[model samples]
Target: MIRRRAFLATCGALGAALLSRRAIAATAEVLASLRSARQRIRTLQARFEQERTLGLLATRVVSRGELTVVLPGQLRWELLPPDSITWWITPAGLAYASSRSRASADRSAAGPMAGVLDDVLVVLGGDPTRLEPRYALEAALQPDETVRVVATPKDSRISAVMRSIEILIDRDLISPRRIRMEESSSDRIEIRFSDVRINQPVDPARMRPPTEPRP
Candidate 1:
């Protein structure tokens, strides 16, 4: 009886090890597929709805926006009227303008939030390869034919401000459907994308930096 019990215990351990290996392998495969899909995107445009919850204030704010990205480093994010603000990120740097103030500010003026914005751009880009250097990624394939990726920051600066980021990608579309950024237990931001257009032509003027004076 003692010998039989020992054998069963050893088999259970072996089975657990095999299951762990399979899970790791599955995650790796999903990441590879994400990398391949992102490589094919040169230009993308989408509409987004963002919900921000402030931990301290216990307030939730919702905004609608449009995003346009031109590969090799160019992006324009505009929040539609009622909260009209736009941010343009290019090879030069980051710049933003507010419709209310009719003023523009450069990266130098963006302060600590600039880094956070830069990280947002990277996440929106949906390139796992670019994110892997700064984040530890784990992915799972969902029953709805979507891939869910969770990224935890490795950089101290980023980790200090962000807890983790979760991205949901549609397998058939090969593009991100939603992204959730957790800043803390109570503070977080969630963005959902729709009407995504891939490899589409975008107006050059839309991506041009604002000429208004810095605040």
Candidate 2:
């Protein structure tokens, strides 16, 4: 617990330093730092909104959204636009909501699934190592600095719902800058953060479960 919290906070605090400065730190050192980084990341609640082009549909769709999260666990994502959807992950399990869509009870597992919260946190907490086996990390160290990690699904569900997930880590702060969620033939979902608050006080209500439907 101590180790993880420290990791999370450092990642949030040293967002800039981790970018271009390649430390003489060993791989273990680097990995250790990332692990702690993920733990201390206390909270991240922000607005993620953007306009996207769908090549398959041959049209542009605009969407606005926000997500709020608390340390080591707990999060919520709401997308409002071409389609309205909200997904919440709590200690209890996964909850998906749309106009009338809810995750089947059988599919709502307690822990974060590979493509769910674990993936979300890896990006937010700045650890490419955890997902490295699946994604190839490409980084830059020059006039323009950026670290881009791309993941190609090795399984059917991952491949069916997603072609690949691309993460953009801003070189200056070592924090996530953007996340590209792509699908084959071009329908995509991209999340760009703004008003991002890390390790700050957040509304507790945001972390609570959503209202359930009537039986």
Candidate 3:
């Protein structure tokens, strides 16, 4: 009985030590890791699968896509199947086109929405600097060496669109593996990325939205 009691005490002490380490980890450490990753990443190309769950739907909707991002603000997200469209983002605004019609729409009225979307994309694209000041950032370094960051928006307009955002980043790879966006309407959009390629030369043409006139 004495031996068992001693073993239990040792286990309890070890658990406490581990928990303490996790609890005391500094936010600066997380920030530094993010900064390091951001520096190493200039561009990102990946295949992603997105699942959107709605409050009333019995079945969740799933979509497959390819994403490309270049530093200094450019992104192309191409959706496939059912209905196909490609969304392009630039510093100016958002543009999208239907693959079937090949007609593009330049939605300048969507500038506010574009800003919010860009903010989330930039963070997931590995540059969190822009968001750190605008959002309350809480980060935890998990046992697997991945960092989980939860960001709550400080801006009322952004908060109105999204309640919060969560991201899982691979520290060693300096890449984001998943992002979950929680909308104020109780809808959830989760995107998982795979086959990621970073800093490789991307065609300049791919960076531009479709040239066809807006419909």
Candidate 4:
């Protein structure tokens, strides 16, 4: 169960990675700018490719997925191809649906994921200031005008699961282009987003796990 908590926490960190890629000095002004930029966002939809490289694995494992986030607290991430799985974090609780099964099930209230579910949900909600209190932030400008932001966790709970997160943002577009998360165990996960749509109306149903009987 400890392993599961770590796994989900790492996965949830992906969403907030984009929040850090501001090309500016690490100062109050920079933090304010970041907050203002992300605050403009209300709804977001994007497709992402997550590549996980583990210390024990000789090759990277890649997964493609699409995610939808609706402000304060609703999110849905669906992994496609090789296997289909959907994870939903909503007002009610956390739930998941697997293609291999017919029912959408809710996570146990005291489950391992319970501890970090809010962390994941908040990241997906695109709140830039949400992580401010927990990480020491730094940003540098690139030759291409892209900003690289690095965030080191200040909280042991977060640092225990991962080392740090690095993000590259396209300054002109004011959007994140790449994110790399480093883990303590020498595992690395990189997520790249494409076809990003912001402030768009996403189907509410998409944020809810499917309700159907197991067949």
Candidate 5:
């Protein structure tokens, strides 16, 4: 009886190992498909609705915005009026303008914030290859046919400020349907995209930083 019990236990362990391997293989296939789809995109534009929850205040703030991305490295994100703000990111640097003030910073001067911006761009760009180097990615196909990918920052500096980023990809469009950034247990931001136009011509003016008001 003792020998039989040990044999059964060993079989159970082997079965579990096989299941783990299969899960890993499935995740790899999903990542490969995502990478291939993202490579074909040159430019993209989308309208987004962002919800930000503050842990300390227990308040939820909602904002509407638009985003434009021109690859190899240019992105413009703007929030509509009342709390109007615009941010432009490119290889050159990061620039932003708000109703109250405007500022620009070079990549080196941006410090840790630069890393955060770069990661955002990578995730939005849907390039797993670039993200794999800095983040640990796990992906699964949802029952609704969407691919959900969770990326955890591997860099200590980034992880200090961000816990993880969750993205839901639309299988047909090969674009993100939603992105959630978890800063902590209670502090998180979720953005949902709509009116997404992929591989479209983005206006050059859209990529430029907002200009300062003339006196």
Candidate 6:
């Protein structure tokens, strides 16, 4: 009877150890995945073809851009070909869009994107530490075996411009596949990445403008 009791006790101890190992493994996976994701984001540049679909028709607003991102909160959205515009996010609010004439009218506007700011900052900046207060975050399954994150803004006006923002990260690499911005009126801005480079040399002049046109 004592032997049986001791055997059962051993079994219980074994089960507990197995469970503890699984929990530790899960933690390690989470940490490894997050680290891989941050590293992938460190060197990312893509050429994007933006299409703005207004209610009835799909209009091709073609813009080929190179994005250079530096760490937790620096990004440059440069539009080349068909037109020229740059959306800069220096964590403050730095952006310049071609005005009416491309040469004579670059006006200042209001909102998060107007200056050195971007919605991605909400997540890439401090969301890791304080996710709840800044965004309503959720995850969904994707066909490509990726887990996608949908972020709804806590900021008022920006939320109006965007219903929700989605970031699709690879199952393995954990790097972003696409950044999709859904507008309130069912319009969407989808930026998919290809030919991505990480942690490469970036010229400061790439973020600099040739001329500032004041309207």
Candidate of highest TM-score:
5
- Candidate 5 lDDT by residue in tens digits, 1-215: 99999999999999999998888788788888888888888998899999999999989999999989888789898999876999999777899989899998888998877878778877887577578888888888999999988889899888878889988989763778999999988999999999989999887777877652222
Q: What pairs collide in candidate 3? A: none
Cα lDDT of model 2 by residue, 1-215, tens digit: 99999999889778757643444233335445445656567777778875576887798777888877775667787887657888776655677777875662323443225354556666666455676565544433334555555566666655676677776655544466788877665787777877776777877766665554432
Candidate 3 residue 8 C-alpha distance from true site, Å: 27
Return the lDDT, model 2, position 47: 88
Model 5, stretches more than 4 Å misplaced?
1-15, 211-215
What tens-digit string does per-residue lDDT give for candidate 3 at 1-215?
99999999999999999977775466557876687768877788999999988876656889999989988688888888775888887765677778556544345677457767888777776567568777877788889989888888998887888888998887663677998999856688999989888898988788787763333
Candidate lDDT values, in order: 0.80, 0.63, 0.79, 0.69, 0.86, 0.58
Superposed Cα deviation of residue 79, candidate 2 (Å): 3.3
Best model per lDDT: 5
Each candidate structure's count of clashing pairs? 0, 15, 0, 0, 0, 8
lDDT of 1 at 154: 90
Segments in model 2 whose C-alpha atoms lie over 4 Å from true places: 1-39, 80-85, 97-117, 172-174, 211-215
lDDT of 6 by residue, 87-171 (tens): 6565334555555432222225454444214446434322332344656656555687775666777778667666777776666
Ranking by TM-score: 5, 1, 3, 4, 2, 6
Query: How high is each candidate's TM-score?
Result: 0.82, 0.65, 0.80, 0.72, 0.89, 0.64
Question: Between candidates 1 and 3, which one is better according to lDDT?
Answer: 1
Candidate 6 runs further than 4 Å off = 1-32, 39-41, 56-60, 97-109, 112-117, 121-131, 140-144, 172-174, 209-215
TM-score of 6: 0.64
Give the runs in model 4 whose Cα sits over 4 Å from its true position. 1-25, 101-125, 172-174, 211-215
